[model samples]
Target: MQAWQGIDEFVSVVEQGSFTKAGQQLQVSTAHVSRSINALEKRLAVKLLHRSTRQVSTTATGQIYYQQCRQLLDGLLDANRTVNQLNTTPSGLIKITAPIYYGERIIAPLFNRLLQQYPDIELDLQLSNHNVELISEGFDLAIRLGSLADSSLMARRIGSRHFDVVASKSYFARCGQPHTIDELNQHNCLRGISDHWHFDVDGRRKDLRIHGSWRCNSGLAVARAAMDGIGIAQLPHYYTDNAVEDGRLMRVLEQHRPHSEGIWAVYPQNRHLSTKLRVVIDFLAAELGEQR
Candidate 1:
């Protein structure tokens, strides 16, 4: 009897909570998956699972058994993945998560280049501003801006960002440009809640709040406001670099620029780093470094 095969089937069924999903994932028929689990129970001489029409739950004995078996199975799978990665090259789906605008503007192009280098890798990008748990979400890695609050994660600093005080040429022509940071109080500003511009002149990092007619949560919207000559917006270099280079917006307070905030690639603290994740992180750090 293939004990490991039966164990694998049992673990899959319990994890998927349904015979059908487990079968599909394992590429076996539902009847076959059921049979495998039944066979496992008979061999173990104990009931391993409680099954209902909607879902499958592990019994106390099953739960303990599952935990022990899961570790063994995962170790075996990790060894296989490691060996395969060493024998071959990096391939398969690599799921990455990053901020929406940052990913589209910065990371996407890098990924395009990476794909050219490794044609075998299938890149899956999920863009969102909300923080996602890398392990729980099944993401290979996550890109984060500023300092991370979670100590459980292992973070590698990739790059840094400087704030740009910007306004459209049209707006500047009407409201006049602020020669000093203090003058920004009198001008219209487009504010994004998530983006709080802070500055450290001689080692004091403090918030530089500016009043605005329009307040938004989206960074792109704030950029659009500045593009349309709505108001002066203090945005990150990532958002304003293209606009500044294109002459659509003018940067102010060049001398009083804030200290650069850090960019990080974060992952769960693990004893072993997967090859796919390690390669991707190194690739992105190089890519973002080029932008600096």
Candidate 2:
């Protein structure tokens, strides 16, 4: 407590750049601020500030001390906030957005569980494939998958998604299994939202352009086409995992399967995350990670 004597006054003076302004901010007189800092300098045996009638500035030693003191003060403030928040029950509506299929298959159910657990907390979840403007649209958060485009939004990885190139057993039996990446050109490759399929080739990622008579933007439709032996399809593990296990579909080019991509919870960088939002994000991260 003794060592903490003049820290507040010194930090405030450095930040405000004037003893008078620092006194105003701390609700003390300018003479009091000046006396406290002088006593601190004598105790430390160091010159902390260069002062004049018109201006005040930190000494080299004072700059270093200010940085460290600022961090300590910030930590103290955060700790106080945490204690206060713990006593406050979270009760508010949180607006969120997520991809359509993932929202239906994954996020929605978890949110249902969350609602059941925290009766006071409400949710408005919007399911869409389009990347909506979170700030402009007034959304609290967004769940994004795969490689994220560069943006200012803050992101936390909740889980991962793996892609599988798969087709029905009957289709493999008729067309024969393709052993290598180049052989994909000869086989009828089903197209989805993207014309290119990702793979890890010789320890590096390679996007192979694929063509086939069958093309659909919907992953479900493309999966159905593959099951019907229309063509081979590339889809996320969630879409094809059950079918592959049940012998409805068989994975191909297993060795070349691309590395998993992160599933992220994205939110505006400047948004103040409330207790409800933090609880929801933590729940989603835990559940989604376990499912993966």
Candidate 3:
């Protein structure tokens, strides 16, 4: 008699293809299943099924009704599961990987706070420039910077970063500032890890191959060199913000600075994400989003 009555029995009958099978699935008698469908059809004012001794099948209207009922049932199950999961306490070891400098300066501190809040959680942090295989290496999460390559791994953008083309005040005074990307060829450009410098030329990303007397694999080393009047260098804001603010270094070619790129939290794809890992990612997104 209720509006919600008979939807389950009707859907089960259509899926099982017979009243007896539907009764077996729902743990009710075939007569009960038939009565429920009959009541449902009468309430809806439609002939919902074609009954025959060999098999039972839905009418055209019943087919449409079954589809809608199935979706509603699925949504109800999901809602119940979400409510149950809300009560689950996060407790587990989470393995994470990140680049060396950023990991130490940014991610490590945020995780330290997370551990303080959840004492049961444990962390295994790996700091390396090399991108490791997440699934094979057993990492639960990775903090990745800039543009990500095409990957099967899932990613969430936590924050953003932009490059700063900087030189020491003394270096700029002696060598002059590069007002345009082409002028970089004339100045002594310090190279870090790669000889290609990134910039924006007329609203398009441009990677300019640079020649420099100074080269270093460490960004900190390159930043220090630029501060000591070595040459101009391109580095992220974290590397140069303090120096630039304190008048130790100067930013040039502001018009050519590339658009800010994403800082991402990446993890392997899974059907169900665990509570601990989910908590960690949410914490990172909240903390880093504030910083930006």
Write down the TM-score for model 2: 0.88
What lDDT tens digits, residue by residue, belong to model 1 across residues 1-292? 4777698889998899999999999999999999989989998899999999877999999999999999998898888877776666777898889999998988888899988988888999999999987888898788899878957888998888888889999999999999877788899978898435665566676676778779888888899899999998988888888899999999987877878888999888885776667778889888777766
Instruction: Indicate the residue-level lDDT of 41 in model 3.
Output: 92
Off by over 4 Å in 1: 1-88, 194-196
lDDT by residue (tens digit), candidate 2, 39-62: 999999999999998999999999
Residue 276 error, candidate 2, Å? 1.9
TM-score ranking from best to worst? Answer: 2, 3, 1
RMSD of 3: 3.3
* Cand. 1 Cα-lDDT: 0.86
Model 2, residue 29: displacement in angstroms?
A: 4.9
- In TM-score terms, candidate 3 sits at 0.80
Q: What is the TM-score of each candidate against the true structure?
A: 0.68, 0.88, 0.80
Residue 201's lDDT within candidate 2 is: 90
Best by TM-score: 2
Q: What Cα-based lDDT does every candidate model obtain? A: 0.86, 0.92, 0.91
Per-residue lDDT of 1-292 in model 3, one digit per residue for the tens? 3987998899899999999999999999999999998999999999989999898888898888889999988888777777766788888899999999999989999989999999889999999999999999999999999889999999999988889999999998899988889999998999988989888888899999999898989999999999999999999988999999999989998898899989999999974678898899899989988874
